[model samples]
Target: MTAPTREPANPRFHKEIVSFTRRGGRLTERQQDAWDDLASTYVLDIPRHTSSTSVDPEFQLDLTETFGREASTIMEIGSGRGEALVHAAHENPDINFLGLEVYIPGVAQALVTMRHLGVTNIRFAIVDAAAALATMLPAASLDELRIWFPDPWHKKRHHKRRLITDDFVPLAARVVKPNGVWRLATDWQEYADQMHEVLLSATGFEYSGVWDERFDDRPITRFEGKGIAAGREIRDLSARRINP
Candidate 1:
């Protein structure tokens, strides 16, 4: 699980790592239309707010101090609707969370949810999680990371669009601290198998277990509910970083 001694030097490393083939992808015409329209609705400048020196007044305590153990920062990839981030932040008040999602409405919805729930420990950005991970997250800064119910892109020709792949896992491994956990869930059994293979082959991860039963802290996501209703089997994979 040793970290890669060097990162790719190309300016496109971020883009290359996560970019997917758009042609023949799983998105329907309607979904594409909605995504285009919704993506444009984003009004906030994410890079501005996240980089600003002014901290949000809602944060009740500095993360290091409140956690007592001094290390409890977590970032969730593809945080849709913000339900999981909001719930996790509310339940574990000591941890600080940053959620990344690309959809405009989803970002706004998550912000509103954070405000309504009166939780101060979470922040969000509208961006592709993989690009953000490479450039935004500090190396070795995350304790836990989750990618739940990401787009399955079920068609064989569209498999390249799926996020969990050999190219991106090394970047995740870089950001996660030693012994940190990474969780991924998907109801698509074929895609789940693909993830298992890709992650197990990645350089910096140690696949701990694959579970048929939900672990204690893994919440049944709204997506998981829809999956269950459709009689799809929920698949979960747990892995840890074995080197700093």
Candidate 2:
């Protein structure tokens, strides 16, 4: 499959924008053990950018080989602590789940949880979500894309740092198969509005508005719980790819 052409950065947002900041934290013993033993098995190694031209084919991830068989694939970006991903993998053993997370401790924590639960359908990669989408993932290969409770970047100046942006919408649309769903959730009202607007305006996607029911299968992570306790409304948006 031919990779989709990445769009130019929107002039509305910051020219040099990043969705996440790398933070340092100490890992628990279990996490460290899992990271050391399971990382080679679960974490993908993506090559750094080598040229200014196009993404190198050598760095592309082979989904069929990664999962050991062909199956429906769901990718969750910013899978913090991996509560939702682990639960989804356990519940849907036939479907392959891949998580992209930049935080080291969160990746380690997820590895430990997966080991304890004996889940085999999930894998992870330590990489920027946009970069991976643009370079590594195969075109029209993903069945679903989930972005739950991504960093809001509340400050006006930092809003450009938010993950859901004008440029990212088309990138997501390019990777998802026709009729595949893109699911998103955020507690911040402003961010939710931005997400809705971006998704609606993006070509090849049809906005379905908010989800009718709570995603009960997705466990409420600590961040989500905090948002609930603070009386923040949890907004969900789902869209389907309408163009190939």
Candidate 3:
């Protein structure tokens, strides 16, 4: 299979290549309550984007200060409503989890669920996942990174906006510890194939091929359930960072 390729980042297309669209959906009353009450406690304060090329050092989250103790950290990119993150955090109290989602409602919903479940080991960030991986995280800081059911962007022209791209793989490798796993899932066949091809060609990662099943730590999200009902097959890809 030919390796998937991405267009070179140009100034004009920089923001257009972002993986997510800024969604404007009104939050439900409960979700608003969660945002009002729990945001200060669980939300991460990321530095504002001055330009796509540079991130302020002051904005980078200090892992020691954020988690209050050194622990294996797992980050979920685009953790929609937090089904997987919340469950994983609750199940593994020893592991600290951070979720990055640009959708405001999704972030609020995740916070609400975490609050109700009394989960303390997880935090949510309203930031661009690719940018966060590129600038906010320290090198060799992450134990695991998960990208689940990200937007397929099925149309040809929109494929550049997909989260798993040629450039993103190297950024991910830089942040993830040696042997750290990067797990991804998508219900779209084309996107899955692209993910496989891209990761296979990327340096510092060993592609294990498609996983036989969903990760044991991940729960069956509502979105995945809907995809299953629609007869879409879920595809999983796992890669381990190999070069230190």
Candidate 4:
């Protein structure tokens, strides 16, 4: 459960460790079309602090007002391409879903999926997940938090950039309600070990002792496909926040 002491040099204004890199790439035809037509509807217009992906700490995100209801809420961290989020939103229309993704193309693609499937219960934000967890969201707001197929940061030196860490565990616990579940999936053994090692002793959460089964509803993404193609075992883990 050792936390890495490494952090990026001079992050302009904040000292918080960032997880994902901002990838700049031209969108595909479908992604561009979806972005043009549906972004205003599905993407949030939240205030930013430092960078475009940075969240404004003082900006309050009222889930009830945004989703137009106060039903059970699920926030998916790093919701790449939105297959699972869209599927769950379509399957259970009563629940409100907010997907946190930094990549534009993935978020655009997610909008494409939602549009094509005619799903309306999901919304997205292009904010840093750490900042969202640390500041923007209300405490005990989410019923479930899902982190699927996060980049494992396989290199020993780059492990500090991995999303699940000692510092991140509390930020996650801060947002999830008491008894709320945090579900995570990965295709790297060492990273999976690191996740369990960190969460096992985390202050506000309790880890399930053994590895959990695959989340059947989650559709295989391109990342997961590559992992499977490389013969890596996909591991799913779950933890529950202790009631305050």
Give the Cα lDDT of each candidate: 0.65, 0.82, 0.81, 0.85
Of candidates 2 and 1, the better by TM-score? 2
Best TM-score among the predictions, by candidate number:
4
Best by lDDT: 4
TM-score of 2: 0.89
lDDT for residue 28 in candidate 3, whole number 0-100: 91
Q: Candidate 1, which segments miss by more than 4 Å at Cα?
A: 1-71
Candidate scoring better on lDDT of 2 and 3: 2
User: Which residue pairs overlap in candidate 3's backbone?
Assistant: none
Report the lDDT of model 3 for residue 89.
Answer: 96
TM-score of each: 0.72, 0.89, 0.90, 0.92
Scanning candidate 4 in windows of ten residues, the lowest lDDT window is 1-10
Report the CA-based lDDT of candidate 2 relative to the real structure.
0.82
- Which ranges in model 2 have alpha carbons more than 4 Å from their true place? 1-15, 50-58
Task: Give a tens-digit lDDT track for model 3, residues 158-221.
Answer: 8888888888888899889998988999888888899888987979998866554778888899
Stretches > 4 Å off in candidate 4: 1-16
Question: Considering TM-score, where higher is better, how would the candidates rank from best to worst?
Answer: 4, 3, 2, 1
Query: Compared with the true structure, what per-residue lDDT tens digits does model 2 show for residues 77-112?
Result: 999999999999999999999999877788889889
Better of 3 and 4 by TM-score: 4
Evaluate residue 90 in candidate 4 and report its C-alpha lDDT on the 0 to 100 scale. Answer: 94
lDDT digits (tens) for residues 70-173 of candidate 4: 89999999988887899889998999999998877788898888989999999898888988998999999999999998888778888889999988888988
